[model samples]
Every structure is written in C-alpha cells, then in structure tokens.
Target: MAIRNVLQLGDPGLRVVSEPVADPGAPEIAALLTDLQDTLTHWRTTTTYGRGIAAPQIGVPLRVIFLHLEQPWPLINPTIIAHSEEQMVVWDACLSFLCIFCQVWRYQQVDVRYQDLQGAWHTVHAEGDLAELLQHEIDHLDGILALDRMTDIRTMCTREEFEKRYRERSPYAR
Candidate 1:
C-alpha cells in the first residue's frame, strides 16, 4: 500500500477507459484500495478538497472508486442503474485537473449497482453530494472528465478565480 501518483489532466492514462475488475476480493484489488486511501488521504491533507478518488486517477485502469465522506466507502465496478429526472448544475473540480473547476450538470439522484471488496453485489440510492461524487468517479472509469461535461467553456475557471468569482454561488464551496 502506497500513495501512488495521481494522473494529471492531459495524461494519456487518464483518458483510457478502465477495465472491469473481475474479482473484487483479489489481493491486488485490496492493495489498490489501500493505495487509493493513502493517496486520497495525502491529497486531502495537502489540498483540503478531495472527497474521493478512482483507481484510474492513480494510473490503475480498474473500475474502482474510493470515497471518504463520513467514512471510507469502496465501490468496485459501479454502474448507475437508475437516476432521477431532476438535475443540478454544480461547480466541479478534479484532482486530475487540480486547480481548475468546471460547471457541470448531474442527476440529483441515482441508484448505483456495485460490488464490494468481498465481491458481493449491492445497490445504493444516492442523492445530493453523494450522487454527484459517484457520477464524477464513474466518469473516470469511462475516460471522461468534468471538463467534458461543461455546457460552456467559459464556465471553467481556476481555483483562485472560483474562490473570488463563484464561491458564493457554488454549493461545493467550503
């Protein structure tokens, strides 16, 4: 278990679609989860902004997402099975794109089917911040970024500019 380097924006690896994990309980998958935790923890301590990370972010082409919201939650091979019609536009930032934030619209609610570390399947109904986080991390599995979801290129701004111009309007502002 180590704090693997997070792939940055424009890194070819970040654009590759990750492969499905055949065995969630595999030793390697456990190690990958540990690496993700170590890396995400490091990022949060340094940047005070990371909530979750995908395996692809650490150059691992696997469908795995590690979220540290109120607790550590690992979703393996997660798929959005359902979503609400309601949507919300949010100012989203990615560790891959460290300093840039982009405006993107996401479902207000979603039902995701995923496997656990024990290789057991489960479905989770997520709304609000959890829904958005799941969608963002899942997008990484499909080689997409928040930048690709922007409705207007002008909506993209640097972190500093976001704080100065859009923080008051951003639900994610902390």
Candidate 2:
C-alpha cells in the first residue's frame, strides 16, 4: 500500500486500455485499491480537487477505480451499462493532467455494473455530479481522457485560467 505516482498526461501508459481484472478479490487488487485510495487522499489534501482515480492513472493496466465521495468506493471491472439520453457540458479536470481543464459533455445519468473487492457484482444508478464522475473514471479504463472529449481546443484552458474564468460557473462547482 503506497501512494503510487499518477501517470501524467502524455505518458504512453495513460493511453493504454486497461485489462479486466481476472479476480476482484486478488491480493494484488487489494493492494492496488489501497494505493489508489492513498494517492487520491494525498491529491485531495494537497490540491483540494481530486475526487477519484483509476488504476491506469498509477500505471496499473487494470480495470479498477477508487472514488472518494461520501466514502471510499472501489469499483473493479466497471462498465457503463446504460446512460441517459441527456447530456451536459462540464469543465472537467483530471488528476493525470492537473495543470489544465477541458470542457466536455457527459451523460446526465448512468447505470454502471461493477464488481466489489469480494468479487460480487453490483449495479449503481448515478446522476448529476456522481454520474459525471463515474463516466470520467470509466473512460480512463478505455484509454480516453477528458481532453479527447473536448469540443474545441479553445475550450481547454490552464488551471489558473479555469479557476479565474470558469470555476464558479462549472457544473461540478455546484
């Protein structure tokens, strides 16, 4: 269990599609989950912005993600089974690319199927902030970044610029 360094943008590893976890209850997965939690915690306390992290962010090509919301939630082999017809534009930032924020559209709601550490399957219905968060994290598993979803290159801006011009108006800010 360690605070593994998050792979930054432009790192080739960040663009590799992660493999499905063969065993959700494997010891290595447990350790990876711990590392993700630690890394996300460190990011939140230090930068005040990270809500979740995917395994690939730490150079692990596994379909795992850790989210810190009301609690620490680890999803193994998560897949977006359904998504709402509606979408919303959001100013999204990634721990992998903390220096910038990109404007991207995300589903307003989603239903995800995933496994727990115990290898049991479960489904979650998420909407609003939670829905956007899940979609972002899951995209990481598929080797996609918010930058890839940007509608226009001009919509991407420096973190400082985003804070100055878009932070308050961001849907995630609410």
Give per-residue CA lDDT, model 2, range 79-162, as digits (tens): 999999999888899999999898889999999999999999999999988999999999999999999988788898998998
Candidate 1: the clashing residue pairs are none
Against the true structure, candidate 2 reaches a TM-score of: 0.96
Q: Highest TM-score, which number?
A: 2
TM-score of each: 0.95, 0.96
> Weakest 10 consecutive residues, lDDT, candidate 2?
165-174
lDDT per residue (tens digit) for residues 72-94 in model 1? 99999999999999998888999
Question: TM-score of the candidate numbered 1?
Answer: 0.95
- Show pairs that collide, candidate 2: none
